[model samples]
Target: MRRLRMGMIGGGPGSFIGPVHRIAAELDREIELVAGAFSSNAGRSRAAGEQYRIDPSRAYADVAALIAGETARADGVDFVTIVSPNHHHLPAARAALAAGIPVLSDKPATATLAEAQELADVVRGAALPYALTYTYSGYPLVREARARIAAGALGTIRKVVVEYPQGWLAGEASGKQAEWRVDPARAGEGGCIGDIGVHALHLAEFVTGLRVTELLADLAAVVPGRALDDDCTVLLRFENGARGVLLTSQIEIGELNGLRIRAYGDRGGLVWKQEEPNSLTLYDLDGGCSMVRAGTALLGADAAARTRTPGGHPEGYLEAFANLYRDFAALLRGEPAPLLPGIEDGLRGMAFIATAVAASRDRAGWVPLSV
Candidate 1:
């Protein structure tokens, strides 16, 4: 099998997500990092290329130069991965697609909803394979949960509760990651909500197969002098009439990446947590509860297909993230990929952010989620 070549943007020094993308994309041995514009500074970008051990000649100063250089080569990159801050996602994706390269971008689509909307048009015009790394959806157990819900094991979903909380920003913070996330010019109008809150919202909807139609939100900047929201609570109305609550905060002291979701239906309930990615909990109407472990025989085809190990062995964050890349490889090879989040998911997530921000800012009781 031929390995697809990948070019990256923004995984410069000290970037947390950039290295993760490289590792995950190569884990299945189906992709290779061939080039990148790793940072805004020309010197730093070249240094990062050397660190990745790629040909330093392929390291460019910006997206435009990268596109020009790569597209001119017969062995150019098979796709482009955008790991920059929210603000850079649009231009990078647009440039790659226009140059006839596929795109895989990090979450929240773009800095603002308007940019996401524009990117949608660009993607459609390019008619190429574009995906968003909604990493949790790649977990084996999470796939099982989705399969069970889709199979009617959960009956009619009546309610949902999802949350993502972290304590790193509970006090004063200073770092490349923290700086870009809190800046509205880079992170958009949402802070915690745009960052982790969008993940919770996507997870709830993805597992339950429900779309959030309306929501009432309360957003706050928990830490003094912060320019964007650090905490938020949202009440949701699903298209099928299911109710939901989403809570996301960066100022919760001592907490880590505790993302969890619970959904109840007429016949039962389902639970999945990010910390414990290997197991899913299911409840029966008769007060019976069961745990479904990943790599077990009880899992559906979707879960089994993604599972890499047998029962009792754990597959974690890196593996989960790798699933997306592996499946994307299949997609580019003309194979089926039912769960890959694409431009539409990107649009919906941005709409969620915009709607939540508007509802909270305007004190609107409830607002429709429209892109």
Candidate 2:
């Protein structure tokens, strides 16, 4: 199988997510980093591209230049990974798509719902494949959960509770990660809700195949006078009559990306924790409980298929992220993609954030979501 020649738009020196994106894309051995525009500053962009060992000529000063030059190359890249800030996603994606290259963007697709809608529309009309990295959805256990729910193993989906909490922003690491995220101009209409809450919301709906028709939300400033929401909670009404609650926060003391989800149907419930991606807890209505280990003796095909190593060997965040990259590559290859959360998921996530933000402003009142 020929590997996808990949290029990146962000992940310049000292950027956190860019490295994560690189590792994930490389993990499955299906993508080769061919070029990049890594940063806004020309020097930094070239330096970051050099760090990846790409030819300096391919490390252009800006996204448009990268698109122009790369598209002209005989062996151009397969796609561009947009790991820049929320504000950069739209322009970068538009450039790539217009150049006839696919895009795999980091989440919250754009800074605003309107922009997100526009991107979705463009991608839909272009008939090109685009994916937003709701990374947790790429996890094996999460896939198992989806499989079970779809197979009627869960019977009737009833309730979903998902929460993602991290404390790096609790005090003040407010340097790069916290700074760009809280900026309305760069981060978009929603704050913590977009940064993490949307992940929780996506996780729930992805697993249960439920659509949140309406919701009520509470956006709180747990941090001292942060410009954007540092913490939030939302109550959800799924189209299938299931009830759900989501809490995503960056101000939780000592919390570090502790994302968890639980779904209860008429017959049983499935619970998975991000910290331990290799295991899922299953609870029967009759009070019997069991743990489904990723590499254990007992494992479903969906779960087993996603597991790359022996049960004890840990395959985690990087690997889950890699699964998404691999699946997207499969999609581009015209092969069967086990899974890929496309532009539709991106639109719904943006709508969730917008609706939640609106609800939070209206005294934590219920808000009907339209998508």
Candidate 3:
């Protein structure tokens, strides 16, 4: 198959997610970084292009020019990826899709559920592939956990608990990383919940094949003077009558990026921790304990395809992130959407964020979801 041409918006100088996106798209060898708009600043966009050997002339000033220029070119980018701030995503994605270009965006679909719903219409109407990167579901073991649960290894899921904690906001962080995210105008409402808690929300549903129907939440601004939530605890009711809890925070001092999940059923339970991505611990109803290690010879093809290197070589965050890119590229190349999280998944994520925010008011009362 011919290599897919890829472009980007909002991942220019000092954007932590841009380089990560580039390297990820590069991993599958089926994608090529042919062009991009990079940043709104002309000089910065040119500089960002120079790093990838894109001629300065094609490095446009903004999304409008990027879409117009790239579309008019003979060898236009087959698709675009949006890695901009929360508020910028809807416009950028709409432009690319309107121009008949596919899109892969960072999570939280849009700044608001209304915008997300509109974008979802565009995606469905255009018959274009749109994906949201929920990094955890890209893990091989997480996929394995989903498969096991689906196959009845864990019957009648009774509970699901996911926790994502980070130390990034443990104190004030300066520079591009912390500034825009903490700024309500750029990051949208519900800081910690939208940014990280949504990740946990997506992970639980993706693995369990269950939807969170109603939630009671307690969202807090643990950071002394922060404008939005930095800690959130959500009580959940699944469509299947399963109960769940999601606890996420950005103020857990020294915890670093710790994401963990535990799902239990009448027949068994399974656990996976993001810090230790390669191992899954299982508990049977009869007290049989087993560990399913990644790269083990006995696993099925799905897990094997995702396992790179040997059993103990320590493939991590970059690889997990890349998994989303690989799947997106595959789908853009005419394959099925990667069963992980995509645009619909992103819409669900936005729903969780918006619902959590609404629930947080009235002292974090219960909110019913349309999912």
Top-lDDT structure, candidate number: 1
lDDT of 1 by residue, 1-371 (tens): 88999999999988999889999999989999999999999999999998889999998998898999999999999999999999999989988998999999999899888899999999999999999999999998888888899999989999999989898998776898899889999999789999988899889989999999999999999899899999999999999999999999999898999999999999999889899889899999999999999878898888898999888888989998999999899989999998999999999999998889889999999888865
TM-score, candidate number 3:
0.96
Off by over 4 Å in 2: none
Ranking by lDDT: 1, 2, 3
Model 2: per-residue Cα lDDT over 31-92, one tens digit each: 98889999989999999988888898998899988988998999999999999999999889
Q: For candidate 1, what is the lDDT?
A: 0.92
**Number of clashes in every candidate structure?**
0, 0, 0
TM-score-better candidate, 1 vs 2: 1
Candidate 3 residue lDDT tens string, 1-371? 78888988878888898888888788878788878888889889988998878767777889999989989999899999888888998999988998999999988888878888888888888888888888887888988999899899999999999999998887885788887777888888769998898899988998898999999988988778888888899999999999999999988889888999999999999999999998999999999999999888856667778877778777777788788888887787677755856667877888888888887877657779874
Q: Each model's C-alpha lDDT?
A: 0.92, 0.88, 0.86
Cα lDDT over the full model 3: 0.86
Clashing pairs in 1: none
**Which candidate do you rate higher for TM-score, 2 or 3?**
2
Model 3 poorest 10 in a row by lDDT:
333-342
Query: Model 1 — which ten-residue stretch has the worst lDDT?
Result: 168-177
Give per-model TM-scores. 0.99, 0.97, 0.96
Error of 1 at 113 (Å): 0.8
